[model samples]
Target chain A: MELFALSDVPEVREGDDLAAIVEDRVDLRADDVLCVASTVVSKADGRTVNLDDVTAGDRARAIAERLEAITGEAKDPRFAQVVLEESNDLVMEAPFILSETRFGHITVNAGIDRSNVPEADLLLLPEDPTGSAERLHEELGVPVVVTDTCGRPFRHGQRGVAIGWAGMPASRDWRGETDRDGRELGVTVESVVDELAAASNLLAGEGDGGTPFVVVREFDFGDHGGSDNLFREYDDDLIRQALQAWEFPG
Target chain B: MELFALSDVPEVREGDDLAAIVEDRVDLRADDVLCVASTVVSKADGRTVNLDDVTAGDRARAIAERLEAITGEAKDPRFAQVVLEESNDLVMEAPFILSETRFGHITVNAGIDRSNVPEADLLLLPEDPTGSAERLHEELGVPVVVTDTCGRPFRHGQRGVAIGWAGMPASRDWRGETDRDGRELGVTVESVVDELAAASNLLAGEGDGGTPFVVVREFDFGDHGGSDNLFREYDDDLIRQALQAWEFPG
Candidate 1:
């Protein structure tokens, strides 16, 4: 597979026509998979929330205070409150606040990003990433994957994940398929969308790396569709059991 | 960045000179990062273990019974016993067995694989991935990252992770570094090695695809060293706290 980031893309703002900008900047091909940073999509969708306009609720204030005392992460309670407004549930509150977002994403701070945006505002994930991807796919006439970076449970650093995707299956399921040794494969589904997101980061640097739009070519997915299957419902996941099992001993 | 898997690699076996085989198959350059599947490394190092030789210990048998009852994963008690032998600690026993390997990797089944192997044998991760990476780096004269697929806590499917790496920093520490907008990046260290691992998966299919070695070119790390920092200490991690909080309800 070949990956290249858009070389000349200007700072994105609200209501920007991203499809036009990307088409103008990069040469598109039929089989290319376009990967866009979720921040840019949020900006185009006018999803920015200003902290100054947010007032921390009692819960947000208490959580923010505890977070600040423990990890020194939240300097302003409004930020924590904004995170709360964007979240479906507060998964954790001590070391860091892990929020389960309405999009069924379990991430830190409800995927509210403060970096690479206006200082006073936080950029929440697109209201509907799959919809955004579908719209972009229609406009661009190719596959599109909306991506974001999040910390993982075991690994120390973050890698990109596909928050929204269209025109390709997020995973390649080889459940009943046999391997070269004729052994039946067990639970060996490949998460293709997340891998594409991580590959895009080779050019989409974490900071000041202007290349947010990546075009991946020559990846033969053969026949594929949407990323809906990549998400495990909260009730079906073991993390729920782990959370219910949580008992902070004195 | 450009990626391509070697199309000419023969079926690897124990005691094969993998570096020589890879060098013979593909040309390596200075700036390239070679990501080899840990299975191949294990195969080269003769790390495969047979079920017939392993007798399930009491803990393994009990854990195997619990896992089999919960997820129907462990077909035999020996599989569970092999996983236990490969792990530093048994982090969990319900739904799945999360093993903390000696190499600081928290993965399911202790990174053991029964697929694509000789029947009745299980493939384990390399004994020392960092040392293996270091040796490969010296032999190939290029950056080497040993990769394995592991399930993430939040995501439904697994992604490739760097178990051992050399030649560049596993994480690009941009802490205190200014963004394009002159904002200081906070905890924005990019995990380059892990990204490469994920990128390599574009060519390295999960099941019986035969393409185990991937060469990633044109990626720049500026200046770097090893993958030591990619591992978070058990004491300094929140997952530990989460695991400690795990008190299974009756």
Candidate 2:
């Protein structure tokens, strides 16, 4: 499939007519999938907080407090946990960078960023990634994905993942099918959109002039439902609990 | 890219030439990437233990004793440390599936299996996935990935991940570039092969008729080196220590 990173667009902000902006930059066909980085969308909409005035330690403390409120549980003062909770959840934490938050979402800084924002503020994830995705789908007549970078438990680096999806099938199930030899197939449900998001992120670098949104064409959707039919309402409490218990390197 | 699963080539047993079997069934070419389920490979090579006669508790105890030797650390049977240890580190642990392993590998039952084996035996992962990759690559003139099914921390179900790789680039880095608007790119490195493995696993299910291997022909590799170049000698102790101190859910 030919994947193209959407370019020549202004920075995305909150409440901005994303569909209008994308339409202006690229030709949005009926089946096209628009994958967006959540950071730009969050920044444009003013979903950020400044931390320059506060000490890093104090900033961490504030994040821990917010986490406690969200999770209804106390967290230790480890700088990583504080940063992680603020971002969403820690995907991977190490000396160089902490990959967390954005949950299954994929982007640089886990879609948490200090760059391209006011000097003192840290941008957070969009309030509702699935909602953002749905809006984009409505505007462009194509599937939409709110993406952020995520770290795999055993792997060393990060890759893009879909946080919220609309207008596309999140997963493609291939069970009970037949191979070339006509044998009954087993369990193979492909996360088609997620892999495409990761592939697009390769061109959308974290800090470069890479486009935050990518337009993927020349792909197959098969018989799966569009994004609207594929959206799932995840339990936030369960997600938070899973994050707290995720295994990461010491 | 379109993905097709290659399955049902007979139960691999000891003395079977795995590479030959794969090449005969699948149209493996020089540029293709083969994703092989590790279970079949393990079973073919006789890395299994039977436990049908023992209770689940006894089975856990027996597994724990073996793991104690491998980990060189005391384990608590009451807490399922052996299962956790087998996962290298626990990324996801629920009632039915446990995702953990030394190489950050994620798999159901910690890459352990009971089906398709003599009622008495349980399968383990291949001893050296990279080596398997290399051997397959040499024979097939394409990249090979040894993968197993793994569950995620919060997400339900399982995804296939690369446990060992050869002939392909495990990751592709897109750093120090400019976007369409000319902003400097920072930390975006795509773990392309792993994501592909995950996507391919959707069709390479863990049931009756699924092919143990998948052949992907059209991935963009760019200027990256082969998987052989990506292999690094890691300190086993560091990995063990990281697992011990890693935050895991009970």
Candidate 3:
């Protein structure tokens, strides 16, 4: 597998043609998989917010006040309001607001970006990343994975993860597959899109110097059963349940 | 960057010189990264166990009984004993044994493998994965990452992660880096090693036909501040604390 980023992708604006940009840049092969950063996707989708435009409600103000007091730093209620509006649930409250976006991706502040946007004060993640990928997949004629970088629990630093994907299954199921000795494999499924996203991150760095689009070539999925269920729901996720019942010992 | 697996790697035996095996197969480059699966590393290091030889104590037996009841399947006390001995702390006791290995990696069953081992009943993770990587790094003159595939919370499937790495820092520190707007970035760090591991897994499949060694070529670490910390300690991880205080509620 080889990954290379598209060079000199101009700043994306609202209603920009992503497929046309890629088509004009290079000839994409049938075997190639495209990994696009969510920041550009959101920017193109006009998912920007001005903190001044948001009106903080009672709950947002209350959360901001508590956050400010806990950290001994100023907190913006308007920012908290934007997070609340974008999220379906909040995973953590005090030190930082770990939120579950309306689309079910859990991350800090619902994955709202504070920097790298030249046009807006905040850049929200693409409303439906999978849908965005599908539109690109239809135009590009290849698999597309929408990538985001976020910190995960029990690990330091952020790496790329697939928030949305199209034209491919999220995982390669190895549940009943036999190992070298013909014994059943312990690893039931391998999440491929997320792995592809992480691989793309090796070429696509962060910030002003970052590349928003990456092309992965010669990555064959081979013969394997496929599954598309990536995100875990309430019952499927135990950590989320644990967090729901426990309180931070502030 | 490109990745290709070394074809026809013979089944690794105890005391096998992995660096020699790779040196024989292909020429090593200064910019190449060798990602070796921990299963092969453990096998080469004789980190295997026989279930018949293990004596399950009261703690292991009690833990096994609870697991058997919850899972409604016959559970082996000897297997539980192995997990207990390999782990430094038990993060979850019921439903499954989520353990923090002595090396600080948190995974189910301390990352023991029941499949893929031709000589033993079980294959434990490398006693010191970093040391193992360092040994390979010293001989090959290239960065080496000892990898393991495991399931994580909030995600439905497994992906590759670096349990041990040598000759390079685990993360690219973007702490004080500025974004396009010259505003300090919110993302403090980017975990590059884990991303490398995940990328390598695209070629390293999970079963009998799986390729254990993947070579990543032309990958650049670039000019960035680096940090070696990968695993999250107790205080640094809020989810770990929550799990320590909460139970499965079964």
Candidate 4:
């Protein structure tokens, strides 16, 4: 397969038709998979929230004060309020508020993005990343993946994952498939969309590198499994189970 | 950045000079990065262990029996024995053995491979993945990343991660870097090597797809941090801490 980032994607604004912008720079193909950053998708969906309008409730204020008191760093109460507002459940509140987003993603700060937005505005994850990807897939008549960056449980650095996807299987299950030696495969279900997202990161660096759209070609899959199929139910997550089992309260 | 699988990588044998083989297929360049699958690296490094020589110890036998009884599926005692031998710590043994390998990777079955090898042979992770990357870097004079497929804590399906890397920073610490909007980035230290590895998966699917070596060009990073630097200490890992704190014993 071949992967490359699209160039000249202008700074997106709320309600901007991103598919039109992408069509201007990217040559559409039936087999190509378009990987778009969640930040840009959120921007197009008007997911940006102004910190000035955010009212820090008691919990948000308490959390912010605790963070500032512990780290001796400035903590924005409004930012904390936004994080709390976006989160479905607070997993931790000490070093950072490790919370579960409404989308069931476990991320620090509830995927509240502070970069690449106007002053005092924060970009939240798209209300429905899968729906966003579907819309782009419809508009462009190609596969699309909406990606976000997050730190993993044990790994040290962040990589992009498919928060939303269309026109491709998010994962390919090889459970009973035979290996090269004709042995039944074990635990080899491959997450192709996340890999595509991560691969796109090679060009879409975390910095203001300006390139937000990535075109992936030659990815082979028999059928498309909706992106929602990739998510584990809340009760089945190992970390969430362990965290909830803890004596500490959220 | 551009990424594509190598066209002509033969079935690797033990003690083969992989860097030399890669050089024959890939055009070397100063800024280019090569992502080598751990399967190929393990095969080249003679890490393939024959199951015929392995005797299932008591613990391995017990674990295998428990798994078979639970799932009502046949379990390979010899496979379980090899996984036990290769792991540094056994994290869980229910549906499968979730162990931390000596390489500090938390994966199922200790990153063992039963595929792409002769019958009754298994491929273990390289002795030192970072060292292998460094050796390749010294010989080929290009950035190299040793990658493996792994399952994440929350996400379903597997994606590639950097098991070892050289000649480039495993992660780019962009936490203090300014974004396009001139806002300081928070928690944006990106694992670029892992991203590249994940990106490579677009071509390197887990089945008998022959594409293992991925050539990546135009990836930008300033300095090298060594792959070992990205590993979080066992004690400091959030998931490990939570898992160990569980009421159930390992």
Candidate with maximal DockQ:
3
Stretches of candidate 2 off by over 4 Å are: A1-17, A20-33, A43-110, A114-123, A168-196, A202-250, B1-31, B43-49, B52-59, B62-108, B114-121, B173-189, B205-212, B223-250
Candidate 1 per-residue C-alpha lDDT over A15-64 given as tens digits, one digit per residue, 9 for 90 to 100: 89999999898879998999999989998988988877889899888877
How good is model 3 by TM-score?
0.99
* Model 4: pairs clashing at backbone N, Cα or C within 3 Å: A199-B199
Error of 4 at A217 (Å): 3.7
Q: Per-residue lDDT for B1-250 in model 4, tens only?
A: 6677887678888888998888888777787899899888888888988878899999999999988987799998988998998888887777668888898888889998777776336789998999999999999999899998888877777888888999887887776677787777754678888888887775776766677898887776744233336777786675666665764323
Contacts from the true interface found in each model, as a fraction, amount to 0.64, 0.15, 0.88, 0.71
| Per-residue C-alpha lDDT of model 3 across residues A117-215, encoded as one tens digit per residue | 889899999999999999999999999999998988888999999999999999999887799988899998999999999999888888677688999
Off by over 4 Å in 3: none
List DockQ for all candidates. 0.66, 0.16, 0.84, 0.63
Among all windows of 10 consecutive residues in model 1 chain B, the one with the lowest summed lDDT is B222-231
Best by lDDT: 3
Q: What is the lDDT of residue B72 in candidate 3?
A: 95
Q: Return the candidate ranking by lDDT, descending.
A: 3, 1, 4, 2
Give the Cα error of residue B245 in candidate 1, in Å: 3.7
Candidate closer to the true structure by lDDT (higher is better), 2 or 4: 4
Quote model 2's TM-score.
0.65
